[model samples]
Target chain A: MSGKVTNGAGGSGDGGDGSEGTPELDAAFFARWMTAAADAVAREADRLTELDSAIGDSDHGGNMRRGFEAVREELGEEVPATPGAVLMTAGRKLVSTVGGASGPLYGTLLRRAGKALGSAERVSREELAGALRTGIDAVAQLGGAVAGDKTMLDALFPAVEALADSGGKDFEAARTAAEQGAEETVPLQARKGRASYLGERSIGHQDPGATSAALLVAALAEADTAVEPEGDADGTGSAQGGSGGSE
Target chain B: MVEAHGGKRVGIVLVSHSKEVADSTARLAAGLAGVPDALVAGAGGLPDGSLGTSEELIVEAARRMDEGAGVALLADLGSAVLTVKTLLAEGDELPEPARLVDAPLIEGAVAAVVTAAGGGDLDTVAAAAEEAYTYRKL
Candidate 1:
């Protein structure tokens, strides 16, 4: 686990080597990232809820939409000066506004990552990847859900792995990996969260949390493309909706 | 605040997926001999009164119920407990010394509330809650 996190951070200084020479991400990038996430959640809210209805409470989509909407409002109200501040503030809002386990779970993810980012004004892609690993670790600790639990970790762990493998330069690759991971949850029996109660009935449905988590990665990739369109034109930006499989 | 019970007692919060479950559990615990004056708050259900837990509601209840003493939370389900822990991790301006008691929900809430109402302090209430795990009804 620590090895993976360290490898993700190893590419922090190689920002200029990418095809587009991506700059260090600042607070503005974080803000845009969150806004994109909010939009994606809104657009996919019903699909998420439908996925949850099969094995869970069918509220994951609504919960995510409400949380991200609150985050967007907070960001618009008072834009934080640093990336950590942006994430921490958004995390706190998610905790307060969103109900259920996902609120706290997702909130802890961002808050832990934000804490790891510390007071840095800007962060290299590798630094962000490392910080995200810290966040995901916190999520696992909080939820007690491992990678095969048919939870968000199903998508998140693989996405983090892809990010590290690419040295954090390939957000699109991470997004694809997350989508594939989410799709992989369709055949898994849930061992955590509300869906675990369904037992074998959960085997055929894609995990709602995992699906929404993929959307979060998609949103981040979209935000990256919006900022550095020229840098990401090398076939990485073309795969818009490869998130296959029915819930 | 004046101590009608003669000393500061640990407060209690009941967290459940169902609002009625939390409220009724608090009521059941409150019926005990020493629990009339103890602060017992019910935090359950979504804002729209649906069947789910809410971290915001739990934090608000914990804040409202805590006096000079600490707060002990008893959750009915795993998600309820997770929600409470997550809210606590968010560093809300809750009173000092709030804890989640890990024991059977109704039994633990009853025991913890009874112990706390008797001025058992934080550790005593927690122990009483844990002791409920050994209670056999057979």
Candidate 2:
């Protein structure tokens, strides 16, 4: 009952699910999540670059920091009206700023996902899960790589699958899944991206893209917990309020 | 002016992680093609003068080269290719009919310029560039 705090306007009714009591997340929630991700990327930039130096280009850290910083700046200047708008804007910024493969890859992920969300003012957890799948699939197609490739998909696939299967309520589980997935990349000989050039030498090095992907998922969980401290225990949040009651 | 067969010549762009590489390739290709008026541009390097391809630069170059005949882009390496692909995927801001040609940089640029100077359309020019892979030096 505490999760029912519908205050959002414009019932997009895009969720289609019959679960009317599910909480809905707005643009502000998505902005908060992106900001949290920016902070996390900034804090771990050096670690990420170090990991990349072991097997791939040594620019992943700097590129990610620059890209997220642009995202943070753009969002701060003008917060978009809807969650989809915010993500789309952020994705464009990343694409234009980051001067590496990560830019386009990450840009496609957010842009496609945002496009899937459409103009819904508020999206339920289930809706968000579906949108994320659309985004992740775009990533795989763009990169021409699949799971076990020691690429970002190593972490992203598991995180999205876990999030979707849990009806998008288990951010903690998604975060844990992402972290484990990244860790598992340490022993994998890369089959895609720059690391693939190293052949067997790429083994024993954790994939920097996977590491950053884990941080992004962890940031999502952190953003949710920061908004609803009480929801941390039951895996629900106050930010995910509105729109669900209208439909 | 290089005469087009029946329409305007297709534009060519060389995208590389290094400015020097892109510019030099453009110069070599244009010089060898003997078409001073050909629309060939070089877009390379980040805004900070680093060794990376800039999406902004690619978009700018493509726009500058676009003359309603479409633009063909040849990228040097990983990030350069990705950047061009990203622009193609976004599709709105970039000029209409821009394509990424998957061919070796120097040879492809030369071939594309030669073909374009001969008044080839976008598809013909791109095919010529990609056909560089089959050129035999031996």
lDDT of each: 0.83, 0.86
lDDT of 1 by residue, A1-247 (tens): 2234345445646345533422357788899999999999999999999998999887888889999999999999988987898999998888777776788888899999888888776676877889899999999999988988999998999898888777777899889989999999999999998789989999999999999899888888999888864444343433323322201
Candidate 1: pairs in clash? none
Per residue, candidate 2 scores C-alpha lDDT tens digits across B1-138 of 344445777889899999888888899999999987347989988977888889888888888888788899999877898878878987577787889998999999999999988888888888888999999899
Q: What is the TM-score of each candidate against the true structure?
A: 0.87, 0.89
Q: What TM-scores result for chain A when each predicted structure is judged separately against the true chain A?
A: 0.85, 0.86
Candidate 1's fnat?
0.63
- For every candidate, the chain B TM-score is 0.89, 0.92
Docking quality tier of model 1? medium
lDDT of 2 at B116: 88
Q: Which stretches of candidate 1 lie over 4 Å from their true place?
A: A1-23, A228-247, B1-6
Q: Fraction of the real A/B interface contacts present in each candidate?
A: 0.63, 0.66
- Positional deviation of residue B32's Cα in model 2 after best superposition, in angstroms: 1.1
Task: Write down the RMSD of candidate 1 (Cα, Å).
Answer: 7.7
lDDT tens string, model 1, B26-97?
A: 888888644563478788887678877887678788888888688998898756877788766768566778
